[model samples]
Target: MQNNRIRLLMLFITLLLPGIAMAASNAKENYGYYCVQCHGMKGNGMGLNIKDMSVQPRDHTDAKAMGARSDDEIFKVIKEGGQSISKSVLMPPWGDTFSDEEIHDLVKYLRSLCNCKLGG
Candidate 1:
């Protein structure tokens, strides 16, 4: 009976491991919570705050431009804010708010949105 219970528990964990991992991935949730408002959910640069800003956010869907930029540049922008690269002061840094892993995953999400690889 004890061995059967342990086996059942192990099977349950194996089946749920993927779901648990996916939940922990948290890229979509993080992006939606932190970036969608400012960068737009579709990544078209027309976010909620665009109307109140001088410079528009870079559209992640802009394949041409986004492809031109390196991932490191994107990472830097996220880490240092727009002002670091003279983009916009309104774009505050999220480096302090997020982990490096989160930022990297966000970058991958941006790439997926654009449908273009870096420097492509």
Candidate 2:
């Protein structure tokens, strides 16, 4: 009985460990997977596409610029795409790609990168 209980506990821990690790890395993982190509790994506007594109992507680490926008605005752009905010058509919509929770998490992660809040 003791051995069985130990084995079950071990199995539970093994299963739960991966989820915990994934949860912690979720924002970064999502950002890397989707945003990094255009936003860059460091959140700078100088992505690989910079040489190929006309308008530059927003630098996520720019506190001054990022501070002017509201969280709702950022969230909207992320969900509905830049065209929804009249910014650019290049920014594709991720509403179909990511869940609301994931979008919110990305917003929060952006805030962290900029070291600024939504509003002044």
Per-model C-alpha lDDT, please? Answer: 0.85, 0.89
Superposed by TM-score, candidate 1 places the C-alpha of residue 35 at a distance from the truth, in angstroms, of: 1.1
The TM-score, computed over Cα atoms with residue i paired to residue i, of candidate 2 is 0.80
Q: For each candidate, give its TM-score against the true structure.
A: 0.78, 0.80
How many Å off is the CA of 4 in candidate 2?
A: 25
Q: Which candidate is the best by TM-score?
A: 2
lDDT of 2 by residue, 1-120 (tens): 999999999999999999766754898899988998889989988778878877899999999999998888999999999999999888989999989888888888899899999664
Native-to-model Cα distance after best TM-score fit, residue 11 in candidate 1, in Å:
9.7
lDDT of 2: 0.89
